[model samples]
Target: MSWQTWRTALISAAATALVVGLLTDTGQPTHPTTVAQASPPASGPGTNHAIDDPLTSERTRAWREDRFGMFIHFGVYSHLEGEYTRPDGTVCRDAEWIKRQCRIPQAEYERFAAEFNPAEFDAEAIARTAKEAGQRYIVITSKHHDGYALWPTKVNRWNLRDHSSFDKNRDILAELKAATERHGIKLGFYYSIWDWNDPDAVHPSTFGRYKERMYAQLKELVDNYQPSVFWFDGEWSTDRPSNPWLTQDGEALEAYVRTLDPKIVVNNRVGKRRLVDGDTGTPEQTIPAEPVSGQLWESCMTLNGSWGYAKWDNRWKSPADLTRNLISIAGRGGNYLLNVGPDARGRIPAESVDRLRAMGSWLVRNRQADAVHGAGTPGIVAEPDWGSVSRKGDTLYASVYRWPGAGGSLTLKALSGFDVRSARVLGSTQRVAVSRSGDTVTLTPSGAPTNDIATVIAIGVAPPAPAAIGTGTGLKAEFWANRKPGGTPTVTRTDPLVNYNWKYQGSPDPTILYSGFSGRWTGFVQPRFSERYTLTTLTSNTVRLWVDDKLVVDNWQDHGPLLSSVAVDLQAGKRHKIRLDFRKESNEAVAKLLWSSPNTPEQVIPTTQLYPA
Candidate 1:
């Protein structure tokens, strides 16, 4: 589905769930009490514990290096081909959610399950296609929101082996697992939290039972296939009114999954896709406007208009558009998980295969695969007007999406004093003429771009060594017991940064309760370059910030993760007094202070730039 529709559904679902009960529980303990909770090395929020988890960091790092993956959305709905004909001679068009959208009765939906025979399903062919697409991993729908399992699940009979005419012994998941292993491609599962067919999941009274089976199914997946990633979805109350999938439930499930496989990387969809929920944020269908703050993210988009097979929806994005999107996402430090919906016969659409092959061919011909594998947001210079820039160590890969006319030049301005050592186009022997005028560098290519999709220009630059750890002592934080900080402080400490997510924790200090607390941070913010910087604050409650004794941001009202910013001019090698006052009114708390300029990427105010006042 499109991101706009998903977001609209989320709002409606959240409202409906909130109306039913925001924190409804089924009398089950939400904690993994048997397992010890790991603490992050720093004083970050409890939500960020997974980000700094020592046990799984290496695995997470490895997954991040993969960069690009394929998402397969295949299920019983594929048989409908995004259409359901009614007895009245009318038709309903919807993909994946055809049953729900068409108002098909439960009996009718179940009856169709028996005829869901995917005779052409070839797991090795699918894996080979992904390999040839230059994709490092594949996340297939083990079970979508329809609650039909692809494997021969022992938890219930609502699975391929038991319900469908497909060979009982030939499990699609198992085949894909072995095939992915053989192809050296990591495999992952996309499991839905909401089960439309499960009676226990739909009714509030039997929700606890559903949770038990869900845990069992997840464990079964882990023990049987040993997937590298768990991409979850359908956690909201979009159709079901009494959805009891709360954040605490997600927390418990995450803990349980960790016990099952400590190396598996999970997406934030495990808990409303919050920053504090899981290992990475799952941005569906649309790439984020910027790199997500304080969390790693991946953008999952479909090859066509729908994630599931849609016979009529043929609005396929061009190969150039897709490749440019991948480069844009990589430039923003995110992975791209492109989706392909197989037909009822289990054959991937020829359009998708052709596009995937084209992308793979381009990457191979241009030798740009290495440039995208572990690339991140460029730190040497600002994003240029011509294209996006991704950084891997000191090397910058500038991907030109819009090629300039013949004899035209590509210019990069507002650089951060990085000395350009060399410039060359990838997959070509032509040398790129590089000239620098102060902070601006102009690159004149020897010839036109190698490919019309995107031309990769490799720039080798030398950045200066970072400042020492003790260059700044950080900001002084004063915590108060009440919502107002006028009274005597309850505790005092030095906080490295103004980033916190106190969702499952008590007060900032041990002296106060979780809610109704306040904090004041005072420091001197030092910039690395002189420019007009946008100082941003993301908070779940009231906050006010002052720089150089001038109040720039005065969002002194309660809110939920609202981002507010104000531009302020600051000079390099100068200290500006920065003061932020925050109040946690109630419930889950979060606060983050970030800054970005023409030359700097959006990031948290570093410890080295924050000196105690």
Candidate 2:
């Protein structure tokens, strides 16, 4: 019924995994188990060590502790409806709105430099408002998919300096950087790896020769701005198949970036297979069951439906929803990057600001519990229930979603190891009765409370070393082809071009799938292990498994992406036959399937089997 009820029930079900190290003797508090040691990466600058480095961990901690940050998406595409236009008058629909709105040719789009004056832009005011809203960082889009550079660059003339009317001399980035620094707020820059204007970046024709100019401009941004974080996006370019950005050369690009600023944090989108530095962006509404140990992750979400300001988009999240999401992310050891789309004039919409302000007020009232370094308690469990709990160290804050008309006693299980010092409603300090028996703790209100929403119950525990927090673990599976024993198998995608017109076919959902336009291709697998196994496909498209049965993956909901996987146990030492059935749905472009295992390199699915599949 209520969100609190649903959250509690979901968390309770997921808590089974957590119950392993928690059960112990009744009188003494149980100490959490030691987390497993992390292995080193197969290849990279920080090889053979934990992937989560000090800088990354520190950043993650700061982010989690900070609890809130601002995201700004402003670029040439903000003005242009589609992505970009070609030299010819014919517009590329792939560019989305940028291509649709900017009917002008390259020459005319270039002249937009003069008309790009954002007279109402106020960097100081924006920074101040963010501070008042209790935000700790400001991430701005320095360059988006449209390839229009916001700051002046020596690598190319397609920048605000040469084209904009803002004194043609003043740099928006420089001003924003200075203002943010003055306000004691960290600044981050969003740089898109896919640039339509750069010949070397991604294009169908010029296969080799990635523009050195692009790297030069990247160096300029790092050297000049010295951003704390380099948020990258748009890696899914149209030219991926032939010029796969994840090649050795692409890895070199990321290494080059780190060389420029070793302290700078980079997101997964920087590399072809998301190998740069951190976790892929998780949407806001989703929460992982286990903490991803030894990895830096942040959930980037919009306050409303869109990341950028859309005049017609009015959907907004409520204050309770925002605060609850923030708590949920923190509980799972992740940061929340809340987005705010400024208008064409570069001012944050007033409505968005008001909502953030409301959230800030709530945070101020509960600063101690929600502070960055606060300990995370196991989530409150509910069974078709009515409330939730927030725990920090010895105290548990129980929030009753609704006051049961009959006023029954509140039951909290799995809390018997600690002593219940007292219970009190948050707004008032009045103590309530708390009783513990075995694994359950019960709390009863002294009288009917005045609150409309939930009430709090604080349970104190005997001080001990806080449970050692675990990062996360990984799951691996192996598959073999045609009962082959020790034979090399080729793994190739049915659609190798990523033409943006292909569809996936398989059973069981794949952990990873490739989707893009232009670079339509399939992955060919060579098995590393020789064993008999089952193959499952996880997709919504019509796919025929050529290996055994002309098994169909899915034939319905052909337009949207779906996940399916095939799993068959195999014996070591064998060669086998493995083939995928793939076809394209109308207007659907691009498809990819990956076969992976513990022996395979992380994030990479081997195309050719080393052994028989």
lDDT of all predictions: 0.78, 0.49
The C-alpha TM-scores of every prediction are 0.82, 0.60
Query: Best candidate, lDDT-wise?
Result: 1
For candidate 2, the TM-score is: 0.60
**Which regions of candidate 1 fall more than 4 Å away from where they truly are?**
1-59, 89-91, 203-206, 240-263, 274-279, 289-294, 469-478, 486-499, 504-506, 509-511, 521-536, 545-553, 564-580, 593-613
Compute the lDDT of residue 609 as modeled in candidate 1. Answer: 88
- What's the CA error at residue 372 for candidate 2, in Å? 5.7
**How many collisions per candidate?**
0, 97
**lDDT tens digits, residue span 215-297, model 1:** 87888899899999999988775544346687757766776777788788998888778766777888887898766665678
What range of 10 consecutive residues in model 1 has the weakest lDDT sum?
Answer: 15-24
- Candidate 2 residue-wise lDDT, 1-613, digit = tens: 1122224323332111101111112221121112232221133211211123332245444554564678887654444322344566553321212321334333444454346666667889878877877778888888765466788875555566655665676788888899999998888888766554544454434423443555666777878888877777655434311223543344445556666776666665664432123333433445555333323456777777656565555789887777656655554545678888776566677888888886666555544234333434343322214454545545555556565444467777752234556666666655567776776767777667544433444556553232223221211112123222123322322321111211221111232222211111222233444332233333223444433333434443454434445555433333334444443333222233434221221122222232222
After TM-score superposition, the amount by which residue 171's alpha carbon in candidate 2 deviates from its true location, in angstroms, is 2.0
